[model samples]
Target: MPLPDPWNRDSLVWRIPLAGGAAESDDNPGVDPPEAWVRALAAVALDLRCLRYGREVNVGRLVWDLAVDSEYFVSIGWQGARGVGGFSRGEGLTVDASFGEAAVWVADTVQSELAGYDFVQWPSRGRHLLLPRLLATNPAWVDPHGGRR
Candidate 1:
């Protein structure tokens, strides 16, 4: 069978950005979602808390990027940290390294978060977030919610 979109240069397994977010259709603006290993963002699904300050960054645009490679995975948790007010700016990066990942050196927290952290280049409408790092998290730690941990 064919592999996935984020295959490493080393040619090992498969990886990709854990794409997830709100599923709003104008009726319910916000709702509490199950807390799980949601890639980079701290909050759960449909969690409007994360997109708090996104307006300041992109106003009303929804932009995203995801990258993956052998033995490592990257994610950009940009919802403006408004995703969770406890979330802060200028912290540089935040990652659950137990999963073998690292937060990139962010230039603009808002822009960086939306662009996936590695941010090699901008995606035109949005900033170029980056997820540039070789992961070291234990394989067993994956999907910690599941028996995978």
Candidate 2:
């Protein structure tokens, strides 16, 4: 069965059964990441002022959906295309550093990475303001080598 849409408040009330007949408990919180990991990621989001977008940005929610073992790298305007769906795995500027190191990297890089792209005068608001830059430089949206797609 499909998991309920996580973004839907009504859907969230439905309790989806755990795989392998596992039970949820404080000692075994199922798929949730450790509190330390969550705090680290939350610190990153806070550093970015992502809370400014409220529910429109998933990073603000401090959800643990990324693969813990994967190497992280920067992704400029990573979530610019998701619209109201907000950030998810593979979104945002990633860092290969440890959580502590990642937090510092984010703090140091966010201002520089997001510089001049604030779209202060753009009519549309929220994270969409970053979309224009994303479209121009994102290889998925443009040919970085200056070749026709």
Candidate 3:
């Protein structure tokens, strides 16, 4: 199956401008989403409070380039203290051992919470906004009132 367009016009994903007078979207070729992992790392990434330049990096446009391009498993990583962010594509579907602490933290956090979810099926519109609501209803990830540590 063709991967879902990460650049869906209606979705929140947008282009980030580079130093030149061009946009990152200019060369980006949207990938066909993997059937096994229906979730957009982008959606979960948006809720993360990680800050950049006194603001949050646009998580909606953060695509797992390695995963989408090579058909491999991918992950997001960051180090708040060091101001570092990274993406990694696993050998197959597993995470690599060389990943840094921040990468591992983000990966572990998201995976643990999404233990049984396949994000590919999430609604195309407002998927980011709805994920918190969905997680709230899941007994494994959230309490009845929808708060968790």
Give the per-residue lDDT digits (tens) of candidate 3, residues 51-148: 21222233333334322223233433222222224333222332232223223333444444333233322112222212222333221222223344
C-alpha lDDT values of all predictions:
0.28, 0.31, 0.31
lDDT of 1 by residue, 38-137 (tens): 3333221122223232233322233222223233333333223323221223231222243222222222343343444333232232332222333343
For model 3 the TM-score comes to 0.28
> What TM-score does each of the candidates earn?
0.24, 0.30, 0.28
Off by over 4 Å in 1: 1-39, 42-55, 73-149
Give the candidate number with the greatest TM-score.
Answer: 2
Error of 2 at 16 (Å): 19
How many steric clashes between backbone atoms does each model show?
A: 16, 0, 8
lDDT of 2 by residue, 1-149 (tens): 43323333221111111111212223223454333333444554443443233223323322223233223222212223223222322233333434554444333334333332433222123343222122232211122234223
List the candidates ranked by lDDT, beginning with the highest: 2, 3, 1
Query: For model 1, where is the 10-residue window of minimal lDDT?
Result: 138-147
